[model samples]
Target: MRRKLAAGNWKMNGSLSAMAEVQALCEAHPEPKVDMLLCPPATLIWPMASMRGEHPLAVGAQDCHPEDKGAHTGDIAAPMLREAGATAVIVGHSERRADHGESSETVRAKAEAAHRAGLLAVVCVGETLEEREAGRALEVVGEQLAASLPPGSTGETVVVAYEPVWAIGTGKVAGTEEIGEMHGFLREALRKSHPEAADAIRLLYGGSVKGSNAAEIFAVPDVDGALVGGASLTAEQFSPIVTALEGA
Candidate 1:
């Protein structure tokens, strides 16, 4: 079976000492059955990567540039993140899309950069409320998935995250059926583009995923895991989601 993962994205929140919660989380539930990751802000990448947790917890970066070195001001490279001990880097998050106006092709180049640096690329895709209401949700998501993923992508090098734009950080979630459709569609989309990676690659759902609904949300077919937000702020908030993942 493909590995299930429960990754927490701290987004723009967290202090220098905030990462200690991950260590507490490990002790609270050591040896998690599913994989786990904490993608903090770029500034915390090195500190969290070097952290010694009671259980293994991979470190991640919120974003990176396609080039190893660039004239781009304030942009970090994927290799820099890898050298800092980060295992993965999130690409094309809705926040990045909205805040930075990143394009799908830009995200693909960033993913390629991560692969070149030997880091996993968590590429994100989603649709807005307007798109969803207009019934263009699937089309938008599928387009993003295709254009945002570069050629030669594989399961080991990249993971797909489905975060419905309308739900992320909004205390809302896509219904199970909708989640299933999007993820399942993405699975096939990747299969068509990279057949060898179809069964092995993991597809994660992100967007207001919390303790009360994590288990059921995770149980949805084609939903291999989640990219948790808000709740990831504390062990108290994030632990239950991990517990639900473990129990699942």
Candidate 2:
């Protein structure tokens, strides 16, 4: 069975003072039923990982370089993230795609790099408002899923997150039917490409996910969990969502 995961993405946010939330979350869920992961900015990975000592919670990085080591300035490698106590890394987030112009091929390469470093790659794919409005949401997301994923990805090594561009950070959560349709489509797409690994792969939904709406989102079929934003910055906001997933 696929274990439900509640992941938090503190995108471009958090500082040393914010590490307290990690401790609070760990304290609140000493024996959590669902898998938990918190991906902070690269600067906080080590510190947050250090704070997680014996907790079941896992620490991850927001992004990683495709190459293990390179002369690329301001780029952190997958191995470096692993060395810094990260067991997973998020790749192909919308922000990276928009701000950095990362293509599916680049995302695929980064996922491979994460695997090479023994870190689970939480790859993301989504459709923009324009694509959805044009009735090409599925087409856009399908192509992304096919091209962004690397070969040999299994439930253990990879996780997929779908975050609609219009919904992310915009507080506009997709309706249950909309979410279910996309997730089901993603499952079918995965089945065709990686038949053996399809059913086992965990599919996560991301986009302004908060405690208030988390349970409803989790109720959708094939939605293994969520890659939460804003609300994940504090235990007060994030713990409830984690608890909801545990019940899901």
Candidate 3:
């Protein structure tokens, strides 16, 4: 069975002071029934990982360079992140695609790099508001998922997060039906390539996930967990969501 995961993305936020939340979160669920992950900004990965102690909390990186090493001045490669105590890295987040003009192929390359570095790649796929309005949400995400995933993806090495572009950080979440449809479709799509491992792969829903609505969202079929945003910055705000997933 796929273990439920409560993953948080701090994005460009958090600092050394903010590490308190990580300690508090770990203390709150030292023996949580489900998995917990926190993807802090690259600067905090080492400190956050170090502070976790014997807790089950896993620290991750928000993004990583596709190449193992190069002349890239501002890019941190997957291996570098792994050395900094990160066990996973998020790829293809909408912000990277929009702000950095990253393509699906670039995302695929980064996922491959993550695997080469022995890190789990949390590959993200989502449709923008315009695409959803144009009735191409499924089509858009399907293509992105197919192209963004690495060729040898497996349940242990990859985690797929479905975060609608418009819903992220907007206090708006896709309806349960919408989430279910996309997650089910994603599972079917994963099966086409990794039929034996598709069912073992954990599918996470993202975009405006919080304590207030987490349980309801978790009730949706095929939603193995969530990739939380704003609410994850604090233990009080995030613990409830983790508890909800534990009971899911």
**lDDT of model 1, residue 186:** 89
**TM-score-superior candidate, 1 or 3:** 3
What is the full ranking by lDDT, best candidate first? 2, 3, 1
Over 23-93, each residue of candidate 2 has an lDDT whose tens digit, in order, gives 99999999999999999998898898888888899999999999999799999999999999999999999
- Judged by lDDT relative to the true structure, which candidate is superior, 2 or 3? 2
> Which ranges in model 1 have alpha carbons more than 4 Å from their true place?
none
Q: What TM-score against the true fold does each predicted structure earn?
A: 0.97, 0.99, 0.99
lDDT of 2: 0.95
* Model 3 quality (TM-score): 0.99
Candidate 3 Cα outliers beyond 4 Å, as residue runs: none
Leading candidate by lDDT: 2
lDDT of 1 at 189: 88
- Return the TM-score for candidate 1, rounded to 2 decimals: 0.97
Colliding residue pairs in candidate 2: none
lDDT of 3 at 219: 95
Error of 1 at 21 (Å): 1.1
Residue 171 local lDDT, model 3: 91
- Give lDDT tens digits, candidate 3, residues 103-218: 99999999999999999999999999999999999999999999998887899999999999999999999999999999999999988978988999999999999899999999
